[model samples]
Target: MGMSAGYELSRRGLKTLLIDAFDPPHPNGSHHGEPRLIRHAYSGGPAYVKLALRADELWRELEEATGEKLLERAGVLNIADPDVYSYAGRFQDAADHGVRIEDLDADQIRFRWPDVRIPDHYRAMFEPNAGYLYSEKCVAAYKKLALHSGASLLPNTFVKRIQAERSFVSVFTNTEHFIANHVILSAGAWFKTLEPFVRLPIRSVRKVVGWFEPSVSSFEAGTFPGFTFASSLGSYYGFPDIAGAGVKIGRHETGEEWQPGEDLVPFGAYSEDEGDLRKALEAYMPDAAGKLLKSAVCKYEHTPDDHFIIDTHPEHSNVILAGGFSGHGFKFASVVGEILANQIELGHWGRDVGLFSAARFSPISP
Candidate 1:
C-alpha cells in the first residue's frame, strides 16, 4: 500500500517519502506469498467491487509501465452454500456491478474442475475475468516506479514516534526524524504501535498459509483457477500451482492475535497450521491434498467490521491512515495507494470513502 501510494504521489510531482520497517517484498508483511486473488464480484461488500474493478485497470496499467508480469487473468471460483453470506453477497454484488459471473452447481464445478468434490447442496460463482496478482513483484514494480518518479525510500527504518501537527507531520524513526506536509500512516501489521494516533478497533493476527502438493495435474496454474470457498466448516481461499509452487491455501478467519514487535513462531508453531488447511483441502479438493510442500506465517490486521479503514487521521487531518485491510486487502493495494494519494492532495477522493473513514471509530486517547 505504501509503495503504490508513493508511486502515485511522486509521479504526480508530490515529494513522497516511503519508510518501511523492513524491505518490502519481504515475507514479514501480508503482501507476500506469491499469488494473491483478486475478485471483482466481491463478497466483502458492494463498495469493494468498484475498487476491485478500478484496481484491475490500474494493475494492468502498472504492468504496462513496468513491463513485468504483475497480474494473471486465470479466473477465480467462489464456492459456498446458498445461505452462506459469501455466496449471496458475491452473487448480489456481481449482479449489481454487472460483472459476469457463471452460476454453477456442484456437478458443473466438478465437471469443469474435476478435483473439486463439493457436495450437491453447494453452489459456485465463477468470475472468469477475476485472477491473481504476483504480490511480491507488484511491490517491487511499484517500488521501482516510485523511485524513478522521485520518491525517496527509507527501508529497515522503524518509526519511533509520530507527531502530527496542524501544518505538517513529524515522523521520527530509529535513525532519523523527517517532516512532511502530509504523512501516510500505512503501518500494516504493526499498526497497533501507533497507539493514540490510531484507535480504530484494529487487531493484528497471525495468519498461516500453506502450499500442498497436488495429486491431480489439473491443479496447475493454467488448468486450475483460484478459489475462495465458504461452508459451515469455515471460509478458505487458495491459488493454483504457479511455477510449480503447488496449490496454496489459507483459512480466512480464526487466527491468533499478533503483537507489534514479535517474531512469529513459524508455520509449524501449531498443528492446525497444516492440519486445518489439510482438512479443508481433503474435504473440497481431495485430489489436491496430496502432501504439504511448504507453509508461511504472515500478519492479518483487521477492523471490527472486517472492512478496510483508508482515511485521514481523526485528530490530525494532515496524516492519513490506511489499514485494517483484514485479510482481503492486497488485491486492492493499487487502488488503495491511488486513493491515499488522492486523499493527500485533494483532501477527498472521487468515490464514496465513507466506508473507509476513521470517523466510524474514536481515536485512542494517549
Candidate 2:
C-alpha cells in the first residue's frame, strides 16, 4: 500500500515521502513469499470484487508501463465440501462483478484435474482470470515508478514518533525529523506503535507458508492452477510450481500470535506446520504431497471483522491510516494505494470505503 500510494501521490504532483523500516522487496513484512493470490470472486463481499477488478486493471497498466510480468493469469480454483462450507457466495460475487467463472462439481473437478482428489460432496469455482501476483516484483516496480515520479523513498529509517497537528504532521525518525502537510501511516503490524495518535483493533499473527516439490508434472504452472480448499480440518491455499519454486501452500485460519520487534521464528523451524500441510495434501491433492522443501513465517494484521481500515485518523484529517488488511488484502493493494492517495489529496476518497472506516470502532480518547 505504501509503495503504490507513494507512486500515485507523486504522480499527482504531491511531494510524497515514503519511509520504511527496512529496504522494500525484503522478507520482513507481509508482502514477501514470492507470490500472492489475486482473484475476482472475493469472499469479503461485493465491494472487494469491485476493488479487485480495478486493481487487476491497474496491475496490467503497471506491467505495461514497467515491462515487467507481475501478474500470472494461470487461474484460481476454490473448492470445498458441501457440508463444510458453500462457495455459492463466491460465484454470486463473480456474477455481480461480471467476472467470468465456472462452477464445477467434484466429478467435474476430478475429471478436469486428475491430480486433485475431490470428494463427491465437494464443489468448486474456477475463475480463469484469477492467478498469483509476483509480490516482490510488484513492490519493486511500484518503488521504481514512485522514484521516477519524483518521490523520495527513505528506507531503513525507523519512525520513532508521528505528531499529527491540525495543519501539518511532524514525523520523528531515529536520525532526523521531517514535516509534511499530509501523512499516511501504512505500517503493517507496527501500526500499534502509533498508540494514542491512531488506535484500531488490530492483531498481528504469525503464519507459516511452505513450498513442497510436486511428485508429478500435473502440479506445474502450465497444467495446474492456484487453488483453495476448505474442509473440516481448515482452509488451505496454494499455487502451482512457478519457476521451479515448488507448490507453495499455507493454512489460512491457523497461526501463532505475533508482535512487531519480536524475534521471528527461523524458516523451517516449525515442523508442525509442515506436517499439517502434508496431511492436507494427502486428503485433497495427493499428487502434491512431496518433500517439504522450504517454509517461512509472515505476519497478518487482522481487524475484528477481518475487513480493512482505510480511513483518516480520528482526530486529524491530514493523517491517513491504512492497515488491518487481515490476510486477504494484498490483492487490492493497487486500488488501496489510489484510495489512500485520494484521501490525502481530496480529504475523502471517492470509493464507498464506509465499511473500512476507523469510525466503525468506538472512539478512543486521545
Candidate 3:
C-alpha cells in the first residue's frame, strides 16, 4: 500500500519516500500470491462499489502509465442462496454506477460453465469486470513507476518510531531519521503499533490457502472463472489456474489470531493444514477438491466488523492511517493509494467513507 501510494504521490509531483521492512514484493507482508477479487457488485456493502469503480479507473491508469496489465478481466462469480444473500444492494449500486453484472441460476450456471456443479438451491451474481490483479506484477510495476516519478523508496529499512508535531512528522528508522510534511501508515499488520493513534480493534489472524492440481486439465485457466461458494458451514473462494499454481482455494474466515511481531512461519514448517480445508472442499466443491498440490499460510488484519479502516489520525490531522483491510482490502489498493495521496494533500477525500470511519469503533469519552 505504501509503495502504491508513493507512486501516486510521485506522479502528482510531490516529494515522497516509500519505506518497507522487507523487499517490495516479499512474502513477509499480506500483499502476496493470495488472489484478490475485484467485484463491483460487492456483497460486503454497496458504498464500496463507488470506491471499487474509482479503483478500476486508477488501476487502468497505472497499467497505461507503466505499460503493464495489472487488472485481468476474467470476471467474478459471487454465489449464494437468493433468499439468504440477496443482491439488492449490490445490484442497485451497480445499476446506479453503470457496472455490468449477469444473474445466473443453477441451470443457467451449468449451461454456461459445465465444469462447475452448483446445487439447484444456489444462485450466482456474475460481474464481467471482475478478475485477478496479478499482485506481484502490479507491485513491480508500481515500484518501477514510483522510482521513475522521482520517489525515493528505501527497502529493508524498518520504521522505528514516528514523532508527530504540529506541522510535520519525524519518521525514525534504525539508521537515520527524516521529516515529512505528511505521513501515511500503510503498514499491513503492524498498524496497531502506532501509539499516538486510536487503539483500533483489530486482530491479526493466520489464514491458510491451498492450491489443488486437478488430476484432469478441465479446471485450468481457459476453462474456469473465479468463483466464491457460500455453504451451510461457511464461505470459500477459489481462483483458476494462471501461474501454474493450480486451483487456489482458501476459507473466507480463519481460525486463529496472532500479534504482528510474532514469527509468521508455518507451525510445523512442512505440515499441511489440508485436513481442515479438505473437509470444507469435499462438502462444498467436491470436484475441484480432489487433488491437492501444496498449501501455505498468510496473515490477515481483521477489524471488529471485518470492514476496512481508511481515515486520518484523530489527533494529528497531517497523518493518515490505512489498515484493517481484514481479508478483502487488496482489490481496492489502486484507489486506496489515490485516497491516501488525496487525504495528505487536500485533507479530505471526496468519497463517502462513513462506513469505514474509525469513529464507528470509538468509545464514549466519559
Candidate 4:
C-alpha cells in the first residue's frame, strides 16, 4: 500500500517519501509469496468489486508503463457447496456487478477441469479475466516507478515513534527525524506500534502457505486455474504451478496470533501447514497432492470483522491509516493506494468508503 501510494502521490507532484522497515520485495510482510490471486467475484461485499475493477486497470497500466509482465490472466475458480457457503449469492453479486463469470455445476467443473474432484452438491464460479499478480514483481515495479517519479524511498529504516500534531506529523527513525504534512501508516503488522496516536482494531496473525509438486501435469498454470474452495473442512485457496515453482496452497482463516518485532516461524518450517494443505488437495484435487516442496509463514493483519480499515486517524486527520487487509487485500493494493492518495489530496475518495472507516469501530456514546 505504501509503495503504490507513494508512486501515485509522487506522480501527482506531491513530494513523497516511501519508508519501509525492510528492503523492497522482502518476504517479511504480507506482499510476499510469488503470486496472489485476483478475482472480481468478491465474497466480502459488492463495494470491493469497484475497487477490484479499478485495481485491474491500474495493474495493466503499470505493466504498460514499465513494460513488465505483472498480472497473469489465468482465470480463477471459486468452488463451494451451495448449502455450506453462499456461492450462489457471490455468483449473483458478481453478475450483478457486470463481472464476466461462468456458472458451473459440479459435473461441469469436473468436465472442465478433470484434475479437480468436486462433489455432486458443489457449485463453481469461473472468472475468466481473474488471475494472479506477481507480488514481488509488482512491488519492485511500483518502487522503481515511485523513484522515477521523484519519490525518496527509505528502506531498512526502523521508525521508533510518530508524533501527529495539528499542523504536521513527526516520524522519528533510528537515524533521523522526518516531518511531513501528512503521514500514512501503512506499516502492515507494526501498525499497532504507533500507540495512542493511532489506535486500530487490527490483529496480526501468522499464516502458513505451502508449495506442492503436482503428480499430474493438469495443474500447470496454462491449463489449471487458481481456486478458492469453501468447504466444511475450511476455506482454502491455491495457485497453479507457475514457472515450475509448484502449486501453492494455503488455508485462509487458520493462523496463530502474531506480534511484530517478535521471532517468527522460520520459512520452510511449516510442516503442519503443509499437512493441512495436503488434506485439502487430497479431498479436492487428489492428483495435485504429490509432494510438499516448501512452505513459508507470513502475517495477516486482520480486522475485527474481517473487513479492511482505510480511514484517517480519528484524532489526527492528516495521518491516514491503511491496514487490516485480512489476508485478501494484495490484489486491491493499486486501488487502495489511489484511495489513500485521494484521501490526502481531496479529503474524500468519492466512493462509499464509509464501510471501511475507523468510525465503525469507534465507541458508542450513550
Question: Which candidate number maximizes lDDT?
Answer: 2
Q: Please give me the total number of clashing residue pairs in predicted model 4.
A: 0
lDDT of each candidate versus the true structure: 0.87, 0.88, 0.78, 0.87
Off by over 4 Å in 2: none
Name the 10 consecutive residues with the lowest summed lDDT in model 1.
Answer: 82-91
Error of 3 at 93 (Å): 1.6
lDDT of 1 by residue, 26-66 (tens): 88889878889998987657788999999999999999998
Q: What's the residue-level lDDT of 324 in candidate 2?
A: 91
Better by lDDT, candidate 3 or 1: 1
Candidate 2 yields a Cα-based lDDT of 0.88
Pairs with backbone N, CA or C atoms under 3 Å apart (clashes), candidate 2: none
**Tens-digit lDDT string for candidate 3 (250-272):** 77775577777887768334343
Which is the better candidate, 2 or 3, if ranked by TM-score? 2
Ranked candidates, highest lDDT first: 2, 4, 1, 3
* Candidate that would win on TM-score: 2
lDDT of 2 at 237: 92
**Model 3, global lDDT:** 0.78
lDDT of 2 by residue, 219-285 (tens): 9998899999999979999999887878899989887788778888875567767888888988988
